[model samples]
Target: MRKFRKDNLVVEIYENRIEMGNSAAEDIADKIKELLAQKDEVRMIFAAAPSQDDMTSNLVKISGIDWNRVIAFHMDEYIGLPRDAEQRFGNYLKKRIFELLPFKEIHYIDNGESDPERICTDYLKKLNEASIDIICMGIGENGHIAFNDPPVADFNDSKLVKIVKLDDVCRQQQVNDGCFKSIEEVPKEAITLTIPVFKRAHNLFCVVPGITKAKAVKRTLEGKISTECPATIIREHHSAKLFLDQDSASLLK
Candidate 1:
């Protein structure tokens, strides 16, 4: 592994995606164990994407995590997809880790009632009820965090959760990831936790792989701290680490 620091963010480049994912899982598992030792339960928010596959898969296999004491939340969800839609972030997590573990609670964002405002208000309340202990996330090909695409990301966003339109690149990424058949099939709007929520989290573990992410990874580490590259904000986080494999780190200097 080649490790270095970019501002407050720690970046680790591994030989392969499997190694990168395993390393991130070990670190995240350690954080969860440490937090559970200090508190009654650990509140965690996760991002659902194909990029997170290896990490989530390995994370669930690690022993001694006390999964029953973990409370789960997903970072974002499409606004109009069916509850059982495979493309739904909530469902993605449910299949990946939520259902595999015995979490104390799994709060899902529901925008199906045609009332995105109410969904945001409800999710915000749940999030505000406790401090987020950790965030397991991935950056989009367009440098987005969660669904906070460049056009809509706000560094000073006051709302904990809000509905926003997905940018063209962000929508195209769904098709690229095979989550949707085409850009036209992707939902244009989504409910996402704001950037402030990420900044406020106690710890962040971002696992990004694939050659498709190389440019975004480069921007995240070298670009200015601005909403234009929302993931760049992770550099300002006190306890954030970015994991990458050769494919994703190819463009980094």
Candidate 2:
């Protein structure tokens, strides 16, 4: 692994996406063991995206994780999409990770609810009721974290979860990732856990791969810590670690 640091953030780069994923999966699996030893249960948050594919796949293969002692949750979900839309973040995760492992429970944001505000509050309560031990996430092509794109990210956001309009760059990225055939097909809005929620997690394992993410990776490691490039906030979290493939880390100094 090629390794480096940006302020408090630790960055690891591997030759290929698979290797990067394996390394992250090993570390997280070990961390889960450490946490479960002291607590009856653990809470984890996940980001659902193509970037997380390799990591989640390898994570499920690791032996000895007491998945029964874990409660799983995802960070964001599109609003106003058809109830059966295959592009929904929850369904993406269900196919990639949730169904691959057996966790005690899985909580997904109900994006189709008639009252988005009320559901956000209900999810916020669930987040506050437990201390999140792990956050498995990724940086977007536009440098967003979850759906907290530049325009909506707040370092001191008052609410744990909120509904917000998706910025153009963010919506277009879905098309680039093949989640949607066109930008018009992507949901214009989403419900997401705010920056403060990510900061509160005891450990943050960020998996960002592909050439498409090179610019965002560079800004995340070299830019000023600000919401303009929301992923830059990772530099402020001492517990956060970034995993990248050579393609993504290529532009970083």
Candidate 3:
């Protein structure tokens, strides 16, 4: 593994996604342990994607974490998927980590809500109830963090969560991840936690792997911080660590 710092962000490159995931999960587990020592509960937000599979799987295997004192929340969910659809972000996280661990609370963004705005307001209330301690996230193939695609991301976003229209590249990525059969099958709209929400988190652990993310990873580390590549914003975060595998870091100079 190799490590470096870019502004306030720490970057770690590992031999493969498995190694990267293991290190990231270990670091997060340590953080959780540390926080639990200081407080009664630890609140975290998670990103659901195939890219996070290794990390989430490893996280559940690690001992010493008091899962009973952890409160869980997912970062985004599709706007129109059926209640039981496997493609829904909530369901994805449910299978990945939510059910694997016994968390104190698990707040899912209801994708089947009849009113998007109403659900956003409701979720915002839940988020604001306490300060978020950590965010486990990933960069999209288009350099988006969460579902805040370039076109919709706002660094100074006023809302904690809101609805967004998925850009072409973002929709295509769902297909590339095998979450949907085709771009047409992907939901064009989603409810996502805004950039400001991530900025407010105490720590951010962004795990991004795979060759398909090379360009996005390059942009996030080397490009000027801008919404054009929303992930670039992490460079300014005070306690953010980006974990990458060789294939994902291939385009980095």
Best model per lDDT: 3
Choose 2 or 3, whichever is better by TM-score: 3
Ranking by lDDT: 3, 1, 2
Can you tell me which runs of candidate 1 are displaced by over 4 Å? none
C-alpha lDDT values of all predictions: 0.94, 0.91, 0.95
RMSD of 3: 0.8
Model 3, 1-253: lDDT tens digits are 8999999999999999999999999999999999999999999999999999999999999998999999999999998888899999999999989999999999999934699999999999999999999999999999999999998899999888999999999999999999889888998899999999999899999999999999999999999999999999999999999999999999999
| Every model: Cα RMSD to truth | 0.9, 1.0, 0.8
Q: In candidate 3, how many clashes are counted? A: 0
Per-prediction TM-score to the true structure, in the order listed: 0.98, 0.98, 0.99
Local accuracy of candidate 2 as per-residue lDDT tens digits, 1-53 = 88888888999999999999999999999999999999999999999999998
- Roughly what TM-score does model 2 have, to 2 decimal places? 0.98
lDDT of 1 by residue, 94-175 (tens): 8999899999999989735668999899889899998999999999999999999999999889888999999999999999
Model 1 per-residue lDDT at 33: 94
Clashes of each: 0, 0, 0
Worst 10 residues of 2 by lDDT: 105-114
